[model samples]
Target chain A: MLSSPGGNPHHPSTVAELGEFGLIRELTSRLDTTPSVHLGPGDDAAVVAAPDRRVVATTDILLEGRHFRRDWSTAYDVGRKAAAQNLADVAAMGAVPTALLLGLVVPAELPVNWPTELMDGIRDEARVAAAAVVGGDVTRGDVITVAITALGDLRDKAAVTRSGARAGDVVAVTGWLGWSAAGHAVLSRGFRSPRAFVEAHRRPEPPYHAGPAAAGLGATAMTDVSDGLIADLGHIAVASRVRIDVRSRQLDVPLQMSDIGQAVGVDPLQWVLTGGEDHAIVATFPRDRKLPARWRVIGEVLPPTGTPQVTVDGAPWDRAGGWDHFGPDQD
Target chain B: MLSSPGGNPHHPSTVAELGEFGLIRELTSRLDTTPSVHLGPGDDAAVVAAPDRRVVATTDILLEGRHFRRDWSTAYDVGRKAAAQNLADVAAMGAVPTALLLGLVVPAELPVNWPTELMDGIRDEARVAAAAVVGGDVTRGDVITVAITALGDLRDKAAVTRSGARAGDVVAVTGWLGWSAAGHAVLSRGFRSPRAFVEAHRRPEPPYHAGPAAAGLGATAMTDVSDGLIADLGHIAVASRVRIDVRSRQLDVPLQMSDIGQAVGVDPLQWVLTGGEDHAIVATFPRDRKLPARWRVIGEVLPPTGTPQVTVDGAPWDRAGGWDHFGPDQD
Candidate 1:
């Protein structure tokens, strides 16, 4: 099971002891406001200065035991991962992340330090993305649930949608591939080596700037790798009505069965193909366009023949396509 | 105990049978778009045009068995109640509600039609507030949770904050006082009567237009009465550093021992004074200002003597202030 931060097993204060308002005061006291936040927490509603006259917004929820487990992820990891996933949505839209609204539901017996640490993780990640905690709500629940909404500005540029791809476009990715899935495999197998993979799974660092940069570079059909590379790409393919084919060799990774892979007893390549939660941005660019230094070409888009599909080496690689919320395994 | 809309007890399709994407498509297909929603659902992020260059944002969470109960309310009631609470926060800011993002977490066995009914409730309430659904996230969880984020525009008017109440300002309220609390009492004691109270509890109809109307008439401070009249007024008192003395007689409510009150054997005034979830607008105006037809004066702000406190009839009313998230009852 995941351990608390202080090392010693001393009992910590429960939320019940502090009360709702008191707990909120303690948790929000650590938040650092940014320039765009005209008003922060404690108000009925927060007023944010949206200088662009347009705001891009998206939301995501993380449920205890579903999206995460206390035994697998620390409280801070949960908070950081939650923020990363939502912010990645804003990035995928070719917008600059600006403000966030967090809603937390927790059990009464939860230690007060857990929520404080979670807020610390959220604020820390927001700082890296230059966003601020504009508002939040706290309530009691049977289990912990975190719902976050991230807002961004388009800065006068058109938002890149998954429907903009065309044939004869090179498919490229800006962040690490299969790392988060690899880390998940390691954790699931009860083995935690290869520090990078484990860390990647716990706290993803999405290439925040690369989204707007790709938009500036005239990239088409952009989306963040959330439900595995192939699954997310399938969304782009269907939306853009284009066929996408990936060249496995083009992915710059040591796909050989390593110690961690052998310990997990799963094909590393399978993880690379269908593993999710990486938060990497995959986009299609005109084949003749010069690629940015951070982007690596991994595939190309083709005109749809019958139905949009994502293939590897011109053949369908049928395996687990990724997570489906209410799929058979869950129920 | 809530019965499905179809009346027949035929087995409804479970969420698992539809999958996440399919369920989302079915649920969101009926959402109506507004002019402010430049980009609506189905995208990674929704782009909302904020012509005022400022956005007012707030969030709230409703958890099953905590904030709501299926045995007492239907899916549509839950959805409408969720939207009403968050939109009330926007109105408390004296802004025009613009858009909303909803995040839903439900058990895999939940009926597919339940979410559709919930969406219908959310959209109907949002229509009254002139807001539209922009984007949302859905996930699988053991219990039902709905987290909503409401966005508004100030339209060049300064946002009315709880910290602006000044001494000699008249306190006013618009909307029902204790109907929701009384409704809660009715449901708790296994008694249902006074259809008005029960309906109020199931679906709060906040005076959405009163907030901006009061702001136009020069309201000094404003807040929604989500936490009993005294408790919410206490928030203004603490934030603005002013003492608020509310006249119990001026509060328009039937404080007599009604049938429900006698059955529950609790003071109706207790609910009027400390009961929450009414979603009424509690605001302050200058003492000499002519009140609008929609506003009723209940008290006046006074300069703080030592510390800010909310008094009733110029005396301290010692009772339960309001609901506490992690109170003794919960743990």
Candidate 2:
């Protein structure tokens, strides 16, 4: 952890002591500029050159306690999750994320090292997708809120949107499913074992390259599974006005973690269906198209039966609940 | 104010009652898409075509009570102010704003009409710059927080960064200075008169076009006056490694509102120097260049004296305080 400019970690400078510009300089110094970032931090606005002229943009705001608990996740984990989620949205659009603009609001008492460590996490995660933190703003607020805006380059290929799915399209997904939900359950139950499950909830690793790869494979539609398999695909269904049917048998959920599932006393299928924050990609491709090795067929799309809908195993899902930000807090 | 789908204004639906997707649809319906937006809301990500290949981007987060208060400003006013500040950043870069992505976090019990009214303000103001709200997200939080990311097109001209100023360059400004600060003072003092000043505090109209115009006129460096004049210019001085001297006599503050200033018992010049949120364009240009009609010379740049600094009238100004988010909250 970096101490204050005074070089004393015991009495680290608060945001008030460092002031806005001073804190900004300290936080920005850790970031290394990339070639794609024509102009990095210190400018009023960042200049990111997208030779393709068209850019894919996405923004997500993560709040403390609501998105991640300080006790459950480290500052690095929060930062990495925030970057991964937004970059995944760009990836879902079949674009390569090139730049990110971060907006952070934290209380005055927040440790200066928290933000620096958070930025390190952001830079590290962005590197996975060949992206960099180009610009950002920091302000004082009551709680910590990270608002990230990620920009991507499609490289001339048309962006894959949820509206492109059609009848006879095959629904496929890349990256793990239900792991975050399972992790949350394990952590909530205070089961320290099954470290992998707990880590999934801490830092989700979305398949960044698989999105563009799926787009190249002629994907009809794509979206990241941030809000559960059924709910996210429901967005694609509604956007494309198609009926999607997920094959229960084909889903690659970690049912092997039976010990954790038993300890929590919850059905693994429930987590697989309604779990959120997995950061995976669920997309639809033409039935006849040969999918790449990363994708696994899990469902099939059908013509809209008067209205768009999603079904599991040719039956309407009885439990349709997913992550609702405004819903009652379960924990 | 728009009621929910039920069309009963007496018992309007709350955000929690409406859920995330439903509330997003309601907020997005009010937005109109611009030609530059290849795809709008309801997608994994928004696609905006710059055509210029290079894009300028900026993000800002505004927290309730800190940035704006519901009792002081209407929902419409808050939304417009949030959009203005971010778009001004793009304009300060000498780019034409093309798209905006808004991320909003509000309490569950907040009225559904509040967000709709806010969206209306955003759309109405964005039209001033020929920009569009291409995409956004809404989540639940304890307070009303708005995060806006704006994108702009340079149209092939190089971005006007703060680092380009040189000695012998003249510093000029467009748009009003210290009006918002005066308005804030008026409102804080509980004086309802001087409606113009109060409105200025509520809604700032940035000189959006003057930015590109100044760039066309070969302005060396530029930034928006979201921060106070001295503080913002301090940024340019440091970035350009030059000395900036402000001529207070050349400033055109609303001296006619001296009665309000006296009533508040604060120097109007203080507001002119340190007041923020005017959204004005302050730029440095060659002294010999024929500036456009909108540009007004207020000072001149000087060689750096081993350290970047700003002076007023050949001497360092005694008053250097400006708005600091983490500093004391002065009314």
Candidate 3:
């Protein structure tokens, strides 16, 4: 194992010591590229081909203390999570990821090897998605912050937007929900888990290919479950002028955090309904369309009434829920 | 003038105060979109056409305290500068900018208006460059950091890289040099500048159109002067396997920064030589090509020796040079 020399006391150097330009050179060294890259690093910009004419793009930022604590998560895990979230966004739009551009900022005193490990995780995730790390920028800052931009190819398929769902469409989801929130609860409460929940929190295993599959199957509307299932689905409901009703019974089978839910004295159903970060692909499709494997029919869309809303089993959920950066943390 | 409530105390009162979903709804409320945007912010991803087949891309991060102190630069100026630098990179690739994706991390206590101002600045700059802001993600962090990804269209022109210069090519530059560096010196050393240099440092006015113009004129190689002119030119020399000889006598024109250089007891030529952050366009053209109006030929590419080097008036320049991120700060 290559033990990362991160935070080593022996190397008491600050970013001010390394300077901006030199640190950039060090970070870019040893990175290789494919033929798709016309110009790589050391140039003013990089040129990449978007042969399909249309490009799908998304961006996300992960802050040091807020998104991932250095003490709780390794540098590699941070990189993986950051890249996964943005790539999931592209997938949610029914586009195949092509390339990623990263912008990283950290204090000068950080261990040099940490960035390499972070890059390793980023490259690992990129390979899994069949994307390339085309270009990136590094600079000095007070804390470690990673911003990633994912570019994707639509492959001539129409983009699955949040506004296309219609009344009578089937609402389906690919992969699990509430797992990350359950894992987050376990981590925040300092409780031990069966490794599954812990892995869920550290590195979310998003259903990478489900987006294109759903698009091929004629998904009307789609979104990744980054926020709670109900909350995110509510977005699609409002955009499509439809009401979404999810059956709680359908969630019982895939809701694997019943034990943790019991220990925390919180409803596992609530976790399934409002918990986020699962990155499951959720979409609306015509009732006549055949659903793909791994996708569970959880609900149905109805015509919007007075206010656009998401309901569970014909009633509004009152559980204080959904992830909010500016709001107080609630388990 | 609206005072930014960025440092306000009573921002997050209760979980119900802003509500996670409610906050996103409010933030994206007034955002307008152009016709080119096939999909906008509330979606899983946005689709934009890259009609030129090739996309020019670049990213940059600006930290609150390190890159710009809040007191020194307004939120709008910070946003403009951030967008400008990334747009300049696309221009350097001989491409026209198309879209920008920004990621912002700020403390929960930050005033909501500050983000609006920042976005306004970004929009203003995008208007100047004929680009649009497509999508972004926001999160809470200790300090404010902005990461921007810029995309551009090459319009079927070949990307002018740093490695295409040949021996005997005439080296020329469009836009001012050393002005930003001089401005930085003035800002840090508490020396008053002649307004132009100070403004230059705060906001560089790079000749964005000159990049594609050089490509149209069949320029062999091109790069933006982010680091000092000598250092950036040296990168071209090393990459293209050529020697570059600069003539200082040719640069006696009265740029707006001459008065500031004179007042500070610093040679204007030194500022012209080693100044950075100018975002000036530098390109190597065939000896017989007709040069643009604003560009002045200042040097020539020579046959490479064993070591790639840049010389002034046939003699090697020995001085503190180049903007090195990890190198020692000359301040």
Instruction: Indicate the worst ten consecutive residues by lDDT in candidate 3 chain A.
Output: A322-331
Model 3: residue B137 alpha-carbon error in angstroms = 1.8
TM-score of each: 0.92, 0.93, 0.90
How big a share of the true inter-chain contacts is recovered in candidate 1?
0.94
RMSD of each: 4.4, 3.5, 4.4
Q: What are the fnat scores of the candidates, in the order listed?
A: 0.94, 0.82, 0.91
TM-score quality measure for candidate 1 = 0.92
Considering only N, C-alpha and C atoms within 3 Å, which residue pairs clash in candidate 2? none
In model 1, chain B matches the true chain B with a TM-score of 0.92
Q: Write the per-residue lDDT of candidate 1 for residues B1-331, one digit (tens) a residue.
A: 2234235455347878768987788777879999999989987899998888889999998888888888999989998999998999999999999999999997899888788799989998999999998889999888889999999988888899999999999999998788888887777657776778889889999999988888888899999989888889989998999999999888776743255566665656677877788799999998888987878899999989854399889888767444322121111
Q: Estimate every model's Cα lDDT from 0 to 1.
A: 0.84, 0.85, 0.78
Model 2 chain B worst lDDT run, 10 consecutive residues: B322-331
lDDT of 1 by residue, A131-191 (tens): 9888899998788999999998888888999999999999999887778877876676577
**Candidate 2 local lDDT, A1-331, one digit each (tens):** 2434345855456777767877787788878767899998878899998988998998988889887788988888888999999999999999999999999998898767778778888988899899999998898998899999999999888899999999999999999888887788777767764888788888999999988888888998999998888989999998898899999989875655555666655667777776778789999998899887878999999988853399999887766344332232123
Docking class of 2: medium
Answer with 1 or 2, whichever has the higher TM-score: 2
lDDT of 2 by residue, B224-322 (tens): 998789889998999899999999899886655677667766667777877889899999999999887777899999999854399888877666343
Which candidate number maximizes TM-score?
Answer: 2
Rank by DockQ, descending? 1, 2, 3
- Candidates' DockQ values? 0.80, 0.77, 0.75
